[model samples]
Target chain A: MTSPLQQKLKINGSSVVTANRTWDGIVVYRTAAKGWSADLAEAAIVRTPDEAKALLAEAVADDVGAIGPYIAPVQVDDTGKILPGNLREQIRRDGVTIDLPV
Target chain B: MYAYDEIDRTLVNERVSEFRDQVKRRLSGELTEDEFKMLRLQNGVYLQLHAYMFRVAIPYGTLASNQLRQLAHVARKYDRGYGHFTTRQNIQFNWIKLSDLPDALADLAEVGIHAMQTSGNNMRNVTSDQWAGVAPGEIEDPRIWSELIRQHTTLHPEFSFLPRKFKIAITASDHDRAAIKVHDIGLRLIKNEKGETGFEVLVGGGLGRTPFIGKTIKHFVHGRDLLSYIEAILRVYNQYGRRDNIYKARIKILVHELGIEKFSREVEEEWQQIRHSSLQIDDEVIEDIRSRFIYPSYEKLPHMPDELRQAAADPDFEAWRKNSVAAHKNPGYAIVTISLKPIGAPPGDATAEQMDALADLADKYSFGEIRVGHEQNLALPHVAKRDLPALWKALDKLGLATPNVNLITDIIACPGLDYCSLANARSIPIAQELTRRFANHELANLIGRLHINISGCINACGHHHVGHIGILGVEKNGEEVYQITIGGRADESAALGNLIGPGVKFHEVADVIEDIVEAYLALRERPDELFVDTVKRLGVEPFKERVYATR
Candidate 1:
């Protein structure tokens, strides 16, 4: 939570709070249930400044397992699902952009 | 092929235990993330894009079979079942859990391998020529000096931290296989007119946001004076290298800022004081390190047995031999390059199964030794010519025999935006697509020796600046695009490539490369003129025109 991304984000649309789980370094998002979820679709999307601040605060307050929390923009498709708004976050939501042998 | 002594084992094991305690504290919140970051990086654990990345040093690109098997075990047990061989002659395992790092370090220590200083702003893993002792016409084996440097620089209290990371590479041959011209410090073994061996020392070469070819600081330093001379350079750099701007912290910037003359004057002043100090290498110690080298027992035999030549009549076997195999210093022996660049797979990646199988093959065919070169490929440094057909077939089954050494598809690339946190765009997909586009397809074989390197960002970990054709990922607007360069070469005559034409979108990169190849083919006066040589001869004017003509 003390990472450089702790600074404010200039959001144009809806956003979500995201971080990597400390022990495993897995990407996770702040969920509507006030907990972390590994899936970005389950992330709590916020549109307003106040909503974004409250949701990111929830992430920053949790230091036990979450680290380097930051706000990233997201978009909602017609199906009412959260989609990462940028290539970087989308790849973080998915795995690597290309096929790599496991 | 250096075996770990008791001291080396104890040092690694003790550090492993100490790091386990540090990780426990970090996880329990007794230590802060900022403090723990330095500790973890010193141990070669990096928090990357999706998961933690653990980098392990493969000393001078040499590995014993059992050591490789241990790596396979770690890859299978702690990671995503594969290890990425980097251009630095190191192996990295992505997707390792932060908590699993301590256990992984312990496991690797059993094989006399540790990831120490593979990251951090300290002296990194010292790399050398892959075919050091086996290659014909090398002035002398450079691994001896590499090992000496490894011991001197590892945990040297004076240089525990520096303005930025430092890298050193030593190559013994005239061909400069180590890419020494672009390293922080390059040491080339040479003989003076007095018939005594010495080193031609070059300093301040590096590749990053700023690229520089190293300039020779000293023409010849006596073999015994190498460590002192190098240490003096480090001392000067540690004092005068920039610390304000992260972009300018490398020694190359300092040398550039002060000009090479002033930098040389500073280094000379410091070296004269330390020339006769305890850092001077003694013959006994060099001999001790040299004696530890696991030299293979060879049978005096004929060169390229008639059988291998006959087998070369088969196109598949012949192509692999001519391209993927190199002449060895020993008669009837071959240095087989087991390329990790498959047609569509990630360059420099080996699955656990492949690692285990390659270990077996190395033990059976190449004196239980394997080497990883800076080109992101693995080499079996000593293989009998007779066993090559079987080796190629086995490698083919493992999906490693791509037969494209020094070919266009034998690319050197970094784990770009896909894994690195600093990348502006993804590099692997571009590399994968280019490989699928060019490897052994169309006139790729006819294109002859060409090198293509890609980097995700300006950090240039992929050595993109020296590629015959370099593709660098950049962001234009909101989408990913690539900036291509032509005519770079990483060799004895190292030169940075010039940017050609405008940057193109990711989807068009493969075609753009095809056009560049086509332009080279058309522009060259003879088929024998290499793509790099053609560019060198004609400059980038014609290729620039050809690539951007339709745009």
Candidate 2:
């Protein structure tokens, strides 16, 4: 019976803070329910999103097999809103968002 | 022109063979890719996205017609029928194969040219004023010192791998068209207190992540001690400059961390150690390099001509004279800049035929010599004033006759995400769009002396940070977007531009730029005020309001 905010807090993944900052994986923030919001960091302020996803595709491929495709299915909420974890997909889905360390 | 003696010829021939063998070893797999990359880069070879690029040095932007003919031959034989003249006064062929590089080197060597140090983190081809010999306002021809530095720094054993890539620009004129401020070292040849000619050396200036106007380290370093002083500076940098982080490796950052006074003291301490050594430029060596740069004997022509007076009466010729031609040292001669930025085209691209036409123009008018400016434009530095009409006719046919040298339309754009692998978005299209949006030559001339630079990424190959109106392209939501910064300059007074507000979408960029221009027009004190001076007088608030009105 954990809330979405609590779930995000529990994930312990890297957070995108700004476009200038570096991120290990693709950082996505859901703006509203079913609306993905990317984290944007100004000079000092950090705005968190409804949902965040870091695609584990590169890490998975390195760990497992290159021939076999790996997918990191990320859910914003429990209502079947899933996002791809690959860097290219994140770039396609969300234009330019801040990436801050969690 | 300095004819190559046996020593010069032998050195070039031997270096060509050495590079030829290096290429052979690379192809045979005896040298690893990493090992061969440095070797090839040292020989001016780069593996660009599509093919191997060979960059040939046009020393201080000076070249002979025979040398250019040789380049044209290489373009026809080995490359894609054209060569890209870069910002460093070097020509790059982007389609050369790895196998044919040696042959290309051999061809270049035949004309006393080599691809040496055109790439790599070495002392690159020394760039000076493209109008060095013919400039009327200059203190002296800087090519003499440029050639001296080229010999002194080329493969100097003690200072090869210092900090990062080092660039040096020398200028004798009051105006710094060579962009002396953006280099690691900027040497200005000036008259000293004792009425002696020497260099007022500036160090720690560059434009990348952290842009800086170089500080004057020495008030006056004697001309004879140029080599010794430069060696001292490099040796000091080599010892203590950061090597761990690539971003912080430039001598500017080193000079930033250690204050200018401290840095200069260290350099002076090092100079004292090496003052009287072999590196100290002797009187004989200076004279030898000086003799090489003396201009050819003139025909003792008249200062003014009636043909020029007639051409001045013609309106089209008058506009071309005002825009294209400059006063030269010789009375009957003029330095004509062939504008490569035709409307809706890349800034510095001359077609294969245009190259031939330029070569022909050089041979016919400019004493069989051609010069390439740092802004990617070609110059007929010694064109006779009487021949301006004929030169205009030839250039007009080739589409090389845009009369906007320092106007708003003459944008300095890099081969952005289109061709370069490191580009985040396309830069050429933005330039083309802007050119089309502001197609009025009169309007462009009205907004005089504004530099617009675009770089796709932050590596800053295009020098976007220093542009008067700088645009940096980044990707946003699978689409191209450009961020605008205003009020940057790269002349003697170099300043990094201030960011206006947010990134504009690719489609809105042209409109935003139009609005910015309109704002400048409304608030300007006079019509003659430049964009930089006006921006300085009135702050960026008006520009920001105009740019972000609809946001």
Candidate 3:
């Protein structure tokens, strides 16, 4: 059985492009300014499948700094704020919710 | 511990430089991810779910206090404040940066530690009985042989890129503490009728998607020809082992397909040509290695100390002493297993402060020596019996004195979906929940010796295959489910667990285990019979019936 992550990729959703920085392996989101940012709040929001695909393509084109570019589902609140739409993405954005020693 | 010679130091430093260059090339995109993956893996750097995970080998499960302190330094300096020790007797840092791995490797080399062969399709760090030299029933120290194998397998040219990863375990005692039967090659040190030391070699035992107990390939192989015999087995495996299917590539599969009789004949034929070659180690070489592991200077003392007798009066100290201490070979000393599976904490994880504290305790109590057991606990092998109360208090201060060794709460779990990319579900949380459920010391003591092992996936890193009560996590319809197994044993009579019925949902797992234990409590013939013994005697039917019964 395939895992949720291994299922067919769907571009049709409110999404933000994400990838890991090549050297440091930190998760980064495609920002509205056409660059990668560590903060998900600064991520460029895409409402349509086409917009998600375009942002993912742009992230892929900027491969010099990142790897494994994919579009992750995010919620756009009434205030136009972005938050992870699922638990997995929330974990990726906020680095292991379990309490860990510093 | 074998002190690093000039040659070892030079080779380690050279490896650090090479890895640094490889990382630099990878960052510059001169090497693609596919090309760099093998290089990084060989150096024990794995790209996990969130970040790069760095693993360092604790060769033969032996470490000096200073070396452990150095590891703590790396944990605090290069990673988060804690590190997770793995079932392979290696420690891993979850959050490692690719850019800092070279420096980390360099720092590790400074303490005579290395990541080489910790991963990749090479012979991994040769493991042995954790109490190799100190165990009472030992015929010979297995660490010497493990060390010899480590030297031979390190960067071995011919076997470097085999069909799959190979693991070899050696044990000198009759008790199978090293889990030799489940390894690719299980070497048991034995003696012949002539009183000559030799090895009883078993081949092709492994746990993964397919679990099989190893079969005896050779009744005995003399110590001098051990390496050549092993090399022969590897040669036979490399030539015929499947490379097309990664699942069928392990030597265990090859032996299973070829049959042990035919496999033994083939290895015997191959060994005839190489038996007298330079690979045959001499008695002097063995003695040299053995000489390096001489016993630490122990002051002569009476067998029983008055302080220990007085301390045994306290129930808490007595409980801790009974569960944590083991009989050492020396009359006045004991082997103390420091449990890493604290209540509510992740199994096998030690904070940097805890690591430093243990190091201090090792120096004060043991002879500055620490051993990492396959069960994910650290051991001070040379602690004087008189110092038990002091050691217990010190351990209590560091939160390491959990007298739950071999109990239900002492779980062996892999870093599952939370960290490992290969995991289908989470293992740590399951272990945590079970530990929390059985947190009461008296309740756990009532349950008695129960090994509850959990694996995140079929890879079986948590050794669920051999647990008395095994929990394997699986993904079902995008949800986490757990499969339970019963009657598995990793001892002299090693056997794989029998699967109970369907997988249980995450929430129902702890309750299911509680039900099974409750049934055991009702069905057991005597208080002395262990959980594994009861399951073995009565079979999995009773437990299966109870587990799958209606609510």
lDDT values, one for every candidate: 0.89, 0.74, 0.90
Local lDDT at B439 for model 3: 95
Mark the regions of model 1 whose C-alpha exceeds 4 Å error after superposition: A1-8, A32-34, A48-58
Error of 2 at B431 (Å): 1.3
The sequence of per-residue lDDT tens digits that candidate 3 reaches over residues B1-551 is 77767888999999999999999998998987667889999999887768889999999999999999999999999898899988889999999899999998899899889998789888999998889899997998899999999889999987789999999999999999999999999999999999998999999999999999999998899999999999999999999999889999999999999999999999999999999999999999998888877579988876799979989899999889989999988889999999999998889999999999999999899989999999999999998989999999999988999999999999999988788768888888888889999999999999899999999999999999999999999988767899999999887889999998899998899999999999999999998789999998899999999988874
**Model 2 alpha-carbon miss at residue B405, Å:** 1.0
Q: Which of the two, 1 or 2, has more TM-score?
A: 1
Q: Model 1: per-residue lDDT, tens digit, B37-92?
A: 88999999888879888999998999999999999999999998999999999999
Tell me how each candidate scores on DockQ against the true complex: 0.74, 0.03, 0.44
Error of 3 at B437 (Å): 1.1
Chain A TM-score for each candidate, in the given order?
0.88, 0.20, 0.83
lDDT of 2 by residue, B1-551 (tens): 55666877898899888878876775565664545667877888764433466788988998888888888888878876877777789888756777787888888888899876687777778899898878887898888899888877777666556667889999998888788888899999998878777999999988877888899999899987888899888988898888888899999999999999999999999999988887776778767777766476676666677888777778877766787889988887889998877788876666556777788888898888888888888888888887888888888888888888887788888767555546677677788888887778778878877888888777777788889899998877767789898898988888888889889887888889899899988988999888888888887899999888777
Which ranges of candidate 2 are over 4 A from the true structure? A1-102, B476-478
Weakest 10 consecutive residues of candidate 2 chain A by summed lDDT: A17-26
Q: By summed lDDT, which 10 consecutive residues of candidate 3 chain B come out lowest?
A: B294-303
Indicate the DockQ of the complex predicted as candidate 3: 0.44
